[model samples]
Target: MVVKLKLEELKLASVVFHHLWTRRNGLIFQDVFQSPSTVTTMAQVDHVMYKEVLTKDSERTARRQTNEFSQSWKPPAWPFYKVNFDVAFDQASGRMGIGVVIGDSEGELMECLIAPKKHVPSVFQAESYALHRVMELCIELGLSQVCFEGDAKVVIDAVNSKEEDSSWYGQKIEDLQQIMAGYPEWKIVFVHRTANVSAHTATKLAIRVSSENVWLEDDPVEVRRSIMDDLVCNVLNQS
Candidate 1:
């Protein structure tokens, strides 16, 4: 009977069998397998498995998915930065807040923005405006490569689609697409609320202020803790 074993299971089974054989007889795998070449093949399989899935990086990824700190801002690739935006809406006061924070590949804060919008009717409107600020900043800074992220699925879906625009913010969305068309390396994505805490903090701060604010290099002390927490998370993932 031929026993078909999966590649992973075969490697595991061979490794276990070899370990036991070496210990029991005080001899190497060559004597147990009766094939000198088998030792090299098993060692190669172990090495490949270690590099592919059994390494420290892979283990950390699994832990991150299940851990409480799973919601984290992922760093962009080199030469590209990530912009995370969020909106705060206050229907009672007829005001909206747009927060945009940019981070580099090393998880350092590159830029921060707080734009307080009036006449903003709904959450969707606020989110769309936040998207607008994010792109406008990217263009002004001559950042051609960027990753725009937000927690609002409605805004992300509408912006990323090439479909006909008809929403209340459709016109502005079209305008954003045109501005972003100049930068082929830019993209918009939606992330979990947890991963969007930094931008949310900025939005909350905007509610207390009356004017548009921009931080080119240093983030305000109010949002520093969240940024520090995010940087710490990134560092832990590397280990």
Candidate 2:
């Protein structure tokens, strides 16, 4: 007999098998018994996290191999700050992670946020929410001559579109436009995921945290490493 499984089905089976093995070990050594629902939920979460890691790795590789000269993270001009935003969504849990990082021309981290949003309807909505929230933050901080960057091409295109948006997230896009109109010096652009690694790292970290955390010049080690990677790459590209 031959068995055929779709890509998603194969991934689900793998996650389920891994979780079952873990449960078996727990039962044998720890005398712990988890219900079927609990096991299934664990498998689902594992699958989501595994996929996220794989996606990020793939994006990083692709960005490096691409011929695009603008693939690397570049610092903004003097007196202008670059704000990068990214989102990670878990459809199984309706939870979304939002990351925003601000850096100066020297590629030094200025401000960053790692937060989670519950009941996010979809990935598109989640990305839109991140962008909107970052805009609010910039306004609150009185930041001008800002360059906003994100990995969501669709959201970036939508925000830059002059035509009206009537989709579910249209209102949010309209709000973003209104906010942009007020700050004429502010600009939003799309970037590859690898170029937004710090924000993306913060986004992944957001999923593990329960509350919003903001840092000023003090980012988590993982996020700090990403910023350093960008800075190093910028230096190499310049030389």
The best candidate in terms of lDDT: 2
Q: Rate the local accuracy (lDDT) of all candidates.
A: 0.74, 0.84
Which parts of model 1 have CA positions greater than 4 angstroms off? Answer: 1-69
**Model 2 weakest lDDT span, ten residues long:** 41-50
Candidate 1 lDDT over residue span 1-239, tens digit each: 99999987786667656534543443452343324444444344344534543454665677678774555777899989999988888855559888888988887888999888885434555666778777878888888889988877766786788897554356767877787788899988878666788999999988888999988778888777888888778778878
Give the TM-score of each candidate: 0.68, 0.73
* Tens-place lDDT digits, model 2, residues 1-239: 98999999899989888668767876897787867776776576456656766786786677669854657799999999999999989866779999999999888889999999886535666888889899988988889889999877767887899988554356778888998999999999988776888899999999889999999988999999999999999899889
Error at 11, model 2, angstroms:
19
Q: What is the lDDT of candidate 2?
A: 0.84
Clashing pairs in 1: none
Q: After superposition, how far is residue 210 of candidate 2 from its true place, in Å?
A: 0.6
